[model samples]
Target: MSALLQQRSTGAARDDARLRDRLVFGDETAFIDLYERFSSLVYTIAARVTRDRRAAEDVTQEVFLAVWQRPLAFDPAKGSLRGWVAMMAHRRAVDLVRREEAHRRTTLDGRLHAEPLGHGDPVGDQVSDADAAERLGTALRALPEHLSRAVTLAYLEGRTYREVAVELGVPEGTAKSRLREGLRRLAVALQSIHAQDGEGP
Candidate 1:
């Protein structure tokens, strides 16, 4: 039984080699097989970087689509097919992280400036926080639909302003302005709520 298992392993390796050769030659079936073999691995790496399951799935799909679109670019002499795919996955994941960080930095700068409330006022602090959140939500909902979407995409999803602009069919500057305006409105609304609650803003 051990000998039989060894033979099967050797056969699978040979089949994988053939499939890789076919991939280099631009065979669709080989590409599909390669995707099937590596999609989960790609997704796992993407998940580690993006820290979101859905984004990981998106990255995985994009990586495979890229592979399919540029099959001719894969140089077998330079690296194994798995290694090449892994590199693509890593690149996509890094891109996601960079885009997310840029969005956070762009939109949340003002909010982060608010000093934390003093200690020994947990109940007041919690109430103030809840009121601020509610007012911000109301202000966000009142924004024009496009501007609201831009704000949500940039701040909530942590998408880059450029990516939000692309998704919304707006200019990059428009995306930035929408985010800036939305954040200003949210900040004002939160301040009003705090003032009403006698929190002194």
Candidate 2:
């Protein structure tokens, strides 16, 4: 048993050194090798912990993505690559489950506690809604270029961050960062925008 353990350790150490070297040099092949070695294990960990196939897949992708983007984060002196990867998968999986739970609770609470909308005269309300939407569109156009483009791609075009990255010719991480920053700026822009007839949002 001890012999087998030592053999496994020796193999993992070799992989750690070789892959670490290639990864630091930005080698796609090394990324592929690392993914091939550990992705299934990561997926299984995520799936078991999250109990959602889609979420597990997302978590697995993110785990590998972090490794690819930050190769130096793994230190051979501190731990084996396999252990680091496993722990990352576990932590990310748990985080995903917690976020899912929080989203569920927020959604449930919103449905339970939301103020009921009064529909006084349906036809009049529809006309008013159309007018409000027109004003909102004008306000949206008044935003700065980056904020406008981000908001348009994400909200208007219904693009996810991945799709937004492709559409905007930016990295996926950059796309998300832009969207988050844009949303914050949009709130402030909306307050200042007085469209056509000059009504505050």
Candidate 3:
């Protein structure tokens, strides 16, 4: 049974490698095969993480699209294609959650600032969002300088990773790495703050 399991694993790895090669060669059928094999698993993981069917669907599509666009990004020597796809889905879902929370906090802060202060403790209502936004800003500032700059350009300024790389005079991969690390640190900082306030991050 152990030998049979090992054989099956070896066969699966070869299949994954062949599919990856076809994908790298721009074969449409290979893309279809990959999606057919992994899309459900990706969507299930995304839904589990994001807890929104629509967002899960979006993340699923985005993950497959990324695979189609960058097939060589996956290294068969490092891991199985299924595991890599699953990890991407989870990472993207978490990033989506973080972005949504940041936008909500930002929007709440904007509305607080925009609304006229007259009735029903507008000032009191502003306090929570104001504090959250302030904490977010402070957290961003606390990131390493390169990471903070990459994140600011890519996210806050709405620049693409390529644009951020060009603007910062760094390679695109380096820019992406910086932005990812920056967001991760920012998420940790904000989660800590939210936990302190008895809120979910």
Candidate 4:
């Protein structure tokens, strides 16, 4: 039984590796093959996790789109192709849930429900967004190189820590540590800046 399992695993690895190579070279056929092979499983996992058909479909599309764009990120040596794709789908779906829940919390006023809030001043919102972006950019630039790279990749670019690890060519544990420390330092730096400006962080 162990031999059978190993053989199957090896076969899948070889198949995925070939597909990856084809994808890296911009082969449409390979992209189609990957989508055909794993789209259903990705969709099913996402649908189950998010409990939203549309979100599941969006997640599935994003997963395949990511594979299509960065084929090299999928390293067969790290794990089986099926497992990797499934995990990506799950992470993305969970991210969507977290973001949606956060939004719901912000909009909710305790247990009591009321009319949705107004859009407020669009121009003021844009100015505030711009100011925040400028402040964050300045703060990020002040961070140490390693911390800046880690935080930028993970937070700004929306890459998972594992993906950040791959991008930074560092161990996964190291990437996680750097991200945590970076976030802490960034908060301190921003708060200090806020103090200087006589505003809240």
Candidate 5:
């Protein structure tokens, strides 16, 4: 990891380790503090991934509930608590998208006798888009922590480069570099997926 990332990770570990201990002991106030600290970030991730306000709200609630119920599930040794919450929200949001897509497909199948499925089909287009979004999310999760944060803040949250730098406690040039490299990696991931599907980039 870069020096900046290492410093950030160390700080997060220290902060989360203390909170995790309180949570493990069933401290209600600690849980409340955790929620207050991460709720907005978690909700923002859910909202961006699911693109539905209601689903985002549901995901945000579910994430914190799970945290309270299974505090030990969070291993501070593995990652920051904030990252874990954001990841859970993203995962839940993606799951909601998949479930909704499946329901739509089932409903559409029943009406398929009236209109055959083919090119230009709206349902097919939606399915393709959802699949791409899911793949992108997977690729994003696969990125290194600093790069992923930079990309998420800049693209998902629509922050400027300077804003990302300030948020990450990094130089503006570093933020831009991370964003460039992250997007390049995402493009590669998408290309590989397309290649696997027999679709040339």
Candidate 6:
């Protein structure tokens, strides 16, 4: 790691120690302090993985919430609290990406049913290109916020669903659902867009 990253890692370790102590003693103020201290770091990781500011923010919030809900569960002997939080953030980011990929694949599959084998003529090429772009855009926009977030993180940012789930503080199953649902929605949206563009789907 770079010097800056090293420093950050050290600071995070310290904060983790503090958090563990506070939680063990049932100090709510200490928990809040920990949230304020690490929220930015969590958000940064989430944004890097998910490639969406809003989604990253949501993930950060969820991470802190998990800490609050299960303060006593964090075992100081096993690892630092910071590491645990970071791991969670990473998982969430991965989940977001997987969901997105699933959505994209589903959309493409749907569009394939109506797509011509070849765009041989200039007019055909232009029409086909336009239809393809429209279909893609529609599919992306049709995803629910969570699903869309997963797609943006996984496909756009090149992260895995496991990372996304950790960052989002959701279960792996939830991450998969987001991807699957997003993809299904994308397929429907693509079909709709194609029909609107005068293509028989």
TM-score leader: 5
For model 1 the local lDDT of residue 52 reads 62
Cα-based lDDT for every prediction = 0.64, 0.64, 0.70, 0.69, 0.69, 0.62
Task: Score candidate 4 by lDDT.
Answer: 0.69
| lDDT (Cα, tens digit) per residue for candidate 4, span 1-201 | 356555765776788799999999999998889888887778765764465667878999999999999989989999767778988997897788667754422221111101121244211112223444457666776778888778755542445799789988999999999999988987787755544443221
Q: For model 1, how does the per-residue alpha-carbon lDDT over 1-201 read when each residue is reduced to its tens digit?
A: 356544654554565567766866778887778777887668755764565667788999999888777776766556456668888987787777777765423333222213232354221223234565556556666777766777656543446789888877889998899889877777676545644553221
Looking at candidate 1, what is the lDDT of residue 187? 68
The parts of candidate 2 lying over 4 Å away from their true place are 1-8, 102-201
Residue pairs with clashing backbones, model 1: none
What does candidate 6 score on TM? 0.44
lDDT of 5 by residue, 24-57 (tens): 8999999989987887777766665555567778
List runs of model 6 lying over 4 Å from the truth: 1-15, 102-201
TM-score (C-alpha) between model 5 and the true structure: 0.51
Compare candidates 5 and 6 on TM-score and give the better one.
5
Better of 1 and 5 by lDDT: 5
- Model 2: residue 196 alpha-carbon error in angstroms: 76
* Candidate 6 local lDDT, 88-165, one digit each (tens): 877776576567755422222222212342444211123233555656755665556678877655543555578668
Which residue pairs show backbone clashes in model 2? none
- lDDT by residue for model 2 over 41-139, one digit each (tens)? 787666645655677789899999998889889988786787799889988876665566544222211111012213532111122234444545555
Instruction: Quote the positional error of residue 55 for candidate 5 in Å.
Output: 1.1
